[model samples]
Target chain A: MLKVTNDQVAGHKAGDGKLGPLIDDLGRFYKPLQSNERGSNELTFYTSFSTNTRIPGPIRRFFPNFYGTQLVEASDGSSLQPHLVLQDFNFGRVNPSIIDIKIGSRTWDPQASEEYIQKGLKKDRETSSLPLGFRLSGFQIYQNRELGFWKPERTFQSLSADEVDLLLRKFVSSNTSANLDLQPDCSFASIVYGGSTGILSQLLELKAWFEDQTIYHFYACSVLMTYEKEFVSNGKIPCAEIKLIDFAHVYEGQGVIDHNFLGGLCSLIKFISEILITPEECTTEASPKDIQKNQIYFEELIK
Target chain B: MLKVTNDQVAGHKAGDGKLGPLIDDLGRFYKPLQSNERGSNELTFYTSFSTNTRIPGPIRRFFPNFYGTQLVEASDGSSLQPHLVLQDFNFGRVNPSIIDIKIGSRTWDPQASEEYIQKGLKKDRETSSLPLGFRLSGFQIYQNRELGFWKPERTFQSLSADEVDLLLRKFVSSNTSANLDLQPDCSFASIVYGGSTGILSQLLELKAWFEDQTIYHFYACSVLMTYEKEFVSNGKIPCAEIKLIDFAHVYEGQGVIDHNFLGGLCSLIKFISEILITPEECTTEASPKDIQKNQIYFEELIK
Candidate 1:
């Protein structure tokens, strides 16, 4: 019942729509975050703000968010390079002095593009020429590389206050003493089931209430899903990973860079929002006696 | 061990010979956050950065934060009004016509301080007041007879994704399935609880990795705290109630103004840091049991 941009829930309108530099109902419920991948092949970004949150005159667009680009070759093959994924990107406002949001790699990296995808697949080179579903929101994850991908990768200004008080007392005493699921001890990446951990030894899942160890905050909604093999297809699993492949209706939050990087921000959503939002809005409401004791594991992950 | 900033954590120098602004080592882990009694004793906020994260105005005076000037009592009881808290507020670069973060409100709400706290607290007057807090992260949540906490509060951009999915499905499934031991859902407030029933509703008491429905995301660290009446420490909670707090950890992320807001910019951490990086670094590896469980939860959050 809530795909609604306004049954007045907030689609609120009053006329000439009081336009002082606009935004009375800008795009109202956001017109599918508009995108043509803005001006050619894609990879655009521009936004800056933060004189301490006094936002106005603002009007933002950008949102398709991420998909393919990073074509570097450079071994003996020179430096193939291409990493594209741009469009609509024209940001501004949110500036601790235009501070670090960088993201203009112009492309290349898969361990230096695995020798540029093995010399463009041994010269068969189509390098997929470019352009399939470009989309992209604002992907700016850097790495000249040494080894990364387990999780817990700090450096958001190397953070400190004792690593934000050891990431909020190991995220509220990691469920009564060490049950941490995985992702943090970051030099970055390692997983054979929660590997090489150490930031707060991973267990946050996705917290959003007054956010972080709370006092007054309650605008909630969260996401962080990361799993890949390109996410699935030939044997299935894609369509936004079979519409949120029901990982037991996810919930784990306390913080350590939000339990190891919002699971890559839930693997770049767009499994067509898998029916926008449901598994009972990402589940979590047990009991009919634990929903009749987990009712066949919640009908086998909503089948 | 990282309270470092006089420079050197990776090589060790901060012998604290104090070249200034090591900020008493994150001020022995932050104590005074205060702001209750009628609020705004002019609260301060600091978070400087550089070493490419840019802040360089001679190391921005080593990050001095929060500048406030306080004294209030003017509901026309003749004067004592002054209040400021601006501090080193820079927003010069990262241009797009230029604005670099702004906020100069004489009134977004608080209509003339709700006609002076409702006709000046029935004429006892010394009232340069502000019971308005609940600015929904600067957007909506109001009620006035001269502000006396009612509870319709809206902000987080005046909620409406179906009142944030009917208040996260009535606080994560009907008052979190009528709380038994899981306690949490009264709207929550008393500083840093992690919203949506704070501390991320302890993942609705887990219920064994959220039985099947699957959608995982948890890793947060958003502390803003403001609530004091500890039975009457004589503190009146005001710094303008940061506009009437209620965060549920601000999450709506897909973009609709901070793109569904929730601590912005996360492209699945740029697709796993653009997938297992390595030119010479960002390779990441470790799983000795998640780096000995993040050094025993960073040694139990700085003990």
Candidate 2:
């Protein structure tokens, strides 16, 4: 009953020597039998599907961040096209202060790979090692219908050291208290991030998810950042939106405690802090010298 | 330590034979100790809390239906106020076409109580019988901030038999297909219900939830019907919005399949059909006779 194309089969094989395709078993690589599309199955699927298609209200409206994959019974017995019924996160309309960016493999720092692998092994005993890299592609930003909201290459290219540091600071403060746990004052955090209350809540949720590495098993996940530009007013940093997408290889367990997400998150935070965090100061604590280091780190990440 | 007042203790004990409160174990009943509020914990929580309060975007903007309860740790060891961070369902601004009405214990037919009790026992083995008359009072519509959106007594008193039939038909048609399941035509349904795509989605979701007896165990859940006036075009019948709320007693389990919701839904549907469905045709098949039956069923339910 399930029909898959030759190119899709090839792409799946190309992912790993014996590793399966990124998608879950419920999902299959679908190609339009009638149309002569040249791109990858995901690319073609995304391209052909119209956003105006009537997605169930719960999925389209409530669960905005994740890609909700639904199974439709094809009455005609003809093969159905595999396309994402994506919720529109109109950052330009919703919150103009935030700049959304999709970070993929290009953003994965090789220097921190060893650390990530070590952490992943310690957390997940069944699979004692992480994959070579998070196989998410930055170029796949075109998957979302909203144009210009996420231009990873352009945004990263244009970013100065100070901008990245400011962005990182805002993200960190929102999720964590002065201590690791315990958000002492909810009012203060809400006040600090005046207009972008929605963005802050989103990031905090994503942070919570990332912390719970036991249940979530994301393979080559893409992290989307909706960074606040004017986060600081008179030097009080707020929060930004950081969410994971493309859960093709994501799995949930009843009580699986691990450091899969945390390891990756730590590696990322470390890499970003290396550039932004001064040798004398902690990542949480900001300093005058952080500006100069930000420039240095920005240049490194850009390269 | 968790501190509680004398009245709060009384309310908790009164819910069951020493079964501490109507709230889940994860939830504890709390009263604003200083306030002179003389309502149930839920009503007091809803009334005292500000809708404009900066609810985390996830709970506020996204996932509007479910009551997301969070534990706030008091740093000073001072008691934190237990209040609902409710998202406002502004029918006036959002969907002017719809009139929202909350149906509570008053809607439960005393005549049908015996049948419902037998049905409930056959479904859930653990809870062998239905709770003595779904103890939710329709008068408790004031539990929500925006008053009069759910004045069921007033709404029913004003509505004629024809109006009641029209509302029920719209709700049933939207949820169930002509043959039951398989809504072949999406566009037709969307066209019939204009503007409030979000409301339509919410009703569909509630319908699905009710259909699923395995997990959802809503004993005395309140039904909030957002009935549209122009449900039909040029006398053509269409669907409207109907959603369930007040998930105070709702529970989920792997194998706890129950007929609590189904019994209520079917009874209402059958009653509506008796009034609307003529001997000559199916309820799905529209006819002028439906108008006649609508009046009859309206009186039956009201009585």
Candidate 3:
């Protein structure tokens, strides 16, 4: 029997007596397919993506390994529903820290309804998506066995560019559990984001693919980053992974560049790269007004 | 500088002042591409196979991970030569035992020249391939730290069906280094060929693909089986892998069944399955004349 996954830190999840994604013992995550066009679109995206010969082997690794779909009893005790079976990133890990950052300033497609576009635009503007071209949808840090999971409030989703940098620093900080008030040590930055197999390299590889690929325009899609928090405390080399997820808003690019997605990815890469290079600047406190100025300056620079 | 791999037990290799496949510190096997149609055909095959979306993800794992190609200094001190860079199966292993078994009774394709067909037929008839549909090209076993390596003479390639079974038995014999005279206990059979991830399961998976896939007809291809012999002695779980190699003779299937290759694969699978089920029969020695009768019987049975 599949159990509801408690580790999901972002996206549409079970709340208010609703059902959500399920996980099995075999390290498979079962995401209940939405019954609307969104569900069919996601299924279509994965189906095409899985069989898309144009995408090279390395680039294909960036997405989750799709194991087809299965009909399972819904978590809400409803009838059997078809679920997308995928490789669980947090499988076989102890005290895993996870973050989901939705890419692109324009989260809604041009073909979307006016209401949908308006709603998406409002959220995009309210969050870091407009200024930074990416927004932290959600994140959860496994501080310690005693302190347990630590996650910022929903308000954190509306962080400015500078606050987003601080969140990124906190995500990699090894000393977060020991001293909450202390600045981030960013000790796990090298293991989680640096090196040849690290998240930074993986993202760069994805960026290389997106630079030329005019196959798809990804809207409201996220880059989910995960790593074992226990590895940091134990001084063990960690296996950190970043996977592209949430393809419901994906659409065909029709031989044109996916500039929106490419821009967001590049912006995210810049922020992470800065955090890796200048860890001190990541945790440095700044006045609220100064943060607002930095946000405006960063947006203008990208523009 | 690339070094000639000492562990290669079969196929065209460095000998008699000739260059062969080279290995580097990065666990990559560099096979010097032939400056002929065969070279281009193989390169085409890999390029197509790598990007082939028709082949499912699971089936794709059976082939070697192709890393494009590189022009390296010819090992024979000639001009620059192109080489196919592939994942080395023997990489990062201690005391590895390896075997190369060329599949199919018909090793040459219909497109081959008369001369090539005649040469291939003679070799196939001389070996177990004609009688059993598969022939052992070569094998090398690491006996121990003291005994170093133990390999049969080239004459072993011409074994009858019964003798081939005996040879397969010898492969899984853990006591070979300790007592060469004793019959094989077949101790490593389950570890190397049993379980879900074992060679048997992997071969079955390949067989499943071959059953339906009509994209290409593989001729003169070899299934390379490798495992760390030290694991058997140390009681550690062994990681055994079976990879399809040598793609020079491949041809377009054109929607026709690859019966030649499939037959050989099934024959090989039958032999291994028997070894796993009845270890006692695997070690049972018969008279030379009786072995000859078994060969004729087996040939007739397959026909």
Top of the candidates by lDDT: 3
For B1-303, candidate 3 gives per-residue lDDT tens digits of 788888888877764557799889898999999889999989999998999899899887778889999998767868688999998877898777888999875687755787886697678767766555688888887778888877644546776566677667777877664233335778889889888988999998997777556688898999988888788678887778898899988888653346567657766876788788888764335465665565454344324
Q: Which of 1 and 2 is the better model by TM-score?
A: 2
**Candidate lDDT (C-alpha), each:** 0.21, 0.32, 0.77
lDDT (Cα, tens digit) per residue for candidate 3, span A184-256: 7788898899999898999989876765565788989999988887886688777788889999999986533
Residues B78-147, model 2: lDDT tens digits: 4344333333332222221233332221222212245563453233212211111122122211111232
Q: Interface root mean square deviation for model 1, in Å?
A: 16.7
DockQ by candidate, in order: 0.01, 0.01, 0.01
Instruction: Rank candidates, lDDT, best first.
Output: 3, 2, 1
Chain A TM-scores, all candidates?
0.18, 0.36, 0.90
For model 3, report DockQ.
Answer: 0.01
Q: Give, for candidate 2 chain B, the lowest lDDT window spanning 10 residues.
A: B125-134
Over 4 Å off, model 3: A1-303, B177-182, B287-303
